[model samples]
Target chain A: MGAIQGFEIRRSSASLRGSATQLRTLPVVAKYIDTSTCIGCKACEVACQEWNDLPVSQTEQVGTYQTMPSLQASYWNLIQFREVDYQGGVAWLMRKDQCMHCADPGCLAACPAPGAIVQYQNGIVDVDPEKCIGCGLCEPGCPFDVPRYSERTNKMAKCTLCVDRVEVGLEPACVKACPTGCLQFGDKDTLLAYGKHRVTALKEGGFAEAAVYDPPGVGGTSVITVLRHGDHPEWYGLPKDPTVPVAVSLWKRILHPLGFIAMGAALFGTLGHFMTVGPKKPKDTSTTSGGEV
Target chain B: MSDASVPASAHPAAPGPSIMRLAVHREDVAVGDEIVRHRLLSRVIHWVVALFFMVALLTGMPIYSPVFGWMATLFGGLSVCRWLHAWSGIAFSVASAVMVLHWLSDMKLVPHDLKFNLVQYMQFSAAEDPEIGKYNPGQKLFFWTIPLVTLMVLLSGIPLWWPTKFGSTLRQVCIIVHDVGFIMWFVAIVGHVYLGTAAEPGTFRSMTRGTVTKAWARLHHPKWFRDVTGDRKE
Candidate 1:
């Protein structure tokens, strides 16, 4: 029994070490939107607005059945329509538009307000209302043009991928509302595998650009898309290359800390001298010591 | 002009008004007015900046997430939050711009200040350099960055507000530019808050009271103290 116990202790120590090393190699979750299977159903769009309680958008007929024209403050999600010629056959391409919830979200990176926008542990992008400061810095950073500024509230608004619901083991409102079995959410690895499988299946069915739209750039989007035609990603209004600007990184990594340190030092040093020295004394007082003159 | 006419004690007497020797320092100099705390105008501007910042934040939260969708109730609803966020952003940018203009004169980077890099200043162990002055290099840098970052935010926000009005490529470029600018601005402001409040003891008073003690002035800005007091002490 003693010998067996000693062997077990040795084995457990080895396993603990291995576990520690494994902990350091946490996998980065890649979120994506699969466009290949997405039908032109407006379920995702309706679900987004309804759950968020966003006001109905006032849109006009602009030669297409697409409502609300484009994404707006009240319209967090929109089903985009693009008529493209695929092998001489006109196909109406559909995509649900919202914040990409990117791994390297430009919106989170650009927001001037601390905690105004943040990326959650599960790779969902969220906004902190208390810290937003209505600077609208996140609006342009998104390649998808996800954020919309509200004039009335003087703040920026966008889809948060139902971060609250996702955290508590619930599907996003839009994902749940998707009746066509088009929108699916799962573990990133599983999703990637499933997306790949779908893409292979679509390619066999004669869709050429039936590949994945999750690029390594922009640190890879959390929302991945498996599109029917690769060429049509742009047509659906997705950027080929999304990246955090070098200027921003330089400012954050170098300039900001430097400014804080320098300023802090100057403030402290100057104040410290004044408190200690009091006022300047006469040169003759050097010999006075602690005694009164 | 006529040093010979003055008594020998006058030289030593000039450095009086020391808090340590109350009668000595207080005899000649009045130590200026009971340090004028932030005047009405300064207070107004400061509070306005703060108020607009809060307004912007509340309105912006719902747009970022449905979790904060509860924040939408503050502004009637999420639709209201959306519109409020954009307009409030404009308000913030404008307020920041006005602040820059208000403090422009004080914030100038003089030639003497060029030697005062933030890195060297942060080395707390070093003897306080006499070259330090009112509003050190770091404060100046912060003041300058506010306007530049505000400009970046405004420029990037415009295209996003109306994407179709701008070409798709231009909009993409704007998004990148805007996002990068916000990140940089956010980090800087964090440091600014720390320094303005908890980092330094008497620093917050400069913004609030609008006046600093003679000792504080002399210690932090020896040159300014000397200039104000006309005392020359090695």
Candidate 2:
């Protein structure tokens, strides 16, 4: 369940050198969600909470069918219910919201704590609570806005893609509990082929903009969805094109190495100056006691 | 005067006057041929700033990069360092603020200071301009850089401490600000320490014992040497 040796870690957040050597022996896994078929019944959400043993959070009457506005620290999964004007009438767009677990995970890239966030060979991104220092870098690092900071534990929490279950050859709890055949899990390549076929079927069935939601900016995600209106992903509470934030990218890529160089230069510059120029001393004191005032 | 091993209490005039001296009065004074560059109060504030700055640096470096992760062990762990860095950072900021306010008048750049070239100063070929005051222009520049960098770190750090209070965009900006500010501050401190100790022979005692020899004062700060000693002879 924890730090399974069977799965090779592809990346470890803030690792000094690099993460464990990726064998790439495991097939990349993914979840296929046909959002067009979802009936807005949040069985997946309940299954996630139950399997993970997350504490129940209080929900207020927000005058909407949605249980809550967004995912919380304890509530790792959510079913976003967005009402949009479609086909000249109001239509409900229900999306099962959770971590995308990107191929190039921003949360992992932005994290400064060693082993706080990790991506396994099977493409599962997980946060280790014990290692998380809760600096909240992951909050801004995520392009999909998945990670939630737990004030109680002083750490960041997010959907682990159910690594505990996946390790035992079991499908994620949410995927297993889905009743409408809307959610399916398997190898990433196989799921993408299935999702694309569904998208083609939707396009032929009068939805012209139907497309597979596998954003290439993030190198694609483990959770690929077939959206009826993929042209307007914002309608489904997803970014049209999501990439790691430029600030985070620059900070991790450029600044980290530059900082070391800058500090080294300061040390060497001072040392070089001292070695050549020597210490400044009074000229007339050479003949005297050298200590004479 | 060269004996750094001499304790602060050994200075006959060091203990009494500064105890009752008001904060408004300048601490720079002379006793016989020895000049008091920093008073007891000034020395205390200076050390407090140094101590807290070191604490902040040690705690923050671990969080900045995993290469220094071992540093977290010195202060319990990474989680402990998270809060310790913030609190120590605040202490360093406040101490720096007090330092800036206390030395503002002395640090103001005059027309002569405008000609102070850093490249020329590093050569160490000639004596100080004789017109130079309590601190050289280079030292004053470093003094002013302290609060500028501290304010950047402090302002950016507040948003980081309570991430939920601020937006993601602001938080990202603060991350950059905090890291860049830290690098600049660290480099400046490195140069400061060098200049305060090894770069100048007698400079360390000014902070340690709050005094410098008349020769040290005359060589480093000639104009202030005249002001303190009333010695018109160059």
Candidate 3:
């Protein structure tokens, strides 16, 4: 639901650095969703589809009103319905789920295709299908499991935060359709301030664990979810402290350069040896190849 | 010419036709007394292994990192590289397996190999001890290490090629192992190429032409040379 006026992509997948153009500065935009006030209406989901002009996906009931099992290639925004045991009875916890668009996006880091993933100066992360090779690297790269691969296109699909509408000085479709006023879109700083105020208000209203769930393990995210139980993100099926996978970090930061160094040293050392020592000569020159044997 | 009727030392014309004799397999009538160091089948299998190894290396490097992404262009793109790398790795493993069995009979390390000093060899100070066989300790060590390393590469590569079949944690570990195995193979192959070609003269031709000069065999593998030619006088 972020408004991304006057923004250019600031950070992007490093593989696409050769083609991507960088901007000097831009205001960051963000989406703030108050989960405590969410009604699980599926309005945002419909709005996302309508605005994006996506096709109706065939779905079957899986023992719950929850639309599809989880996020699908056709559905970017979803309302996760979970029945939790309250003080005495069961209570429904509905959280609107979408891409987090992290400051340090693991998908961007792990992507091998150039320009396949990009982050805007306003903090909207987008995937360029033209550059995508359908390698599915972004699937495992994401800690949140937000990106889904479409078999039809053989490319990754995820939430773009209504980047098109936000680019034209309008709020995202989901924010406009939220009847409960739970979804808010604005400059990142203003939204953070408003989110903080809302969390305090909820805490005062007898919600003990009411807090802003902007996880810092991934350097925070553009989408901030205000949760009633922020301490236990796992209850919402979110990683408690989601960070980039260990192998991805080691592969990109450590092994990438280390491999080059090792190969270079070996090649150069061998070359030096060949130049210095020359070739070993056969000691006995008297006999021919087919000797007494 | 290496006339089988006369001593090579007495034939001054040996040099003139020794080059032509390379066209035939002279296991008995050495090219001016040059020995058939490697047989035709042995040379063919060695090159087959080398070809597969190089193919695997070039194709696998790009998939490992975007830094080497240009290599993908050679095979069309990363998608093609992914499949090509898998097939090449399979071929390389199979060829290496064949090479292991083919060379196993001669590659065995003897008690003399325990005394082989790499430091002395590197400094060009080691004498040609008659105990050395068709292969030195360094070559034998590489021969033994490669099959193990190649198997590791193949096993680790399997998970990466079909990641979803395995757990995420195991897939992550496999990626690291595959990358490490790739680097290890790179180092080993570079050294092998250098030793076979530039470092040791007349060594590469044995694998290509399937023969080496008697003088080369005598200097490099004196014991093998003595066994073949019955020339113990080093």
**Top-TM-score structure, candidate number:** 2
Ranking by TM-score: 2, 3, 1
Standalone chain B TM-score for every prediction: 0.73, 0.88, 0.87
lDDT of each: 0.61, 0.85, 0.78
Instruction: Tell me the chain A TM-score of model 3.
Output: 0.90
State which candidate has the highest DockQ: 2
DockQ of each candidate, alpha-carbon based: 0.09, 0.71, 0.45
Q: How do all the candidates rank in terms of lDDT, highest first?
A: 2, 3, 1
Q: What is the C-alpha lDDT profile of model 3 across B96-123, one tens digit per residue?
A: 8999998897888778799888757765
Error of 3 at B218 (Å): 1.7
Pairs of residues at least 3 apart in sequence or in different chains that clash in candidate 2: none
lDDT tens digits by residue: candidate 1, A1-293: 01111011111100111112222332334445667667677888788878888877787676666776778877888878878776687777777887777777767765655456665455666665655655455654666667776766666777777766665667788889887677777677888888889888998998866877876767677677888877657877777676665544444456545644654665565466445433232223332243321
Q: In candidate 2 chain B, where is summed lDDT lowest over 10 consecutive residues? A: B1-10
Give per-residue CA lDDT, model 2, range A64-155, as digits (tens). Answer: 77888888899999988889998899878999999999999899999888888888888889888888889888999999888898888788
- Of the two candidates 2 and 3, the one with more favorable TM-score, higher being better, is 2
Q: Which stretches in model 2 have alpha-carbon errors above 4 Å? A: A16-24, A286-293, B1-26
Name the runs in model 1 displaced over 4 angstroms.
Answer: A1-32, A84-91, A112-114, A261-293, B1-234
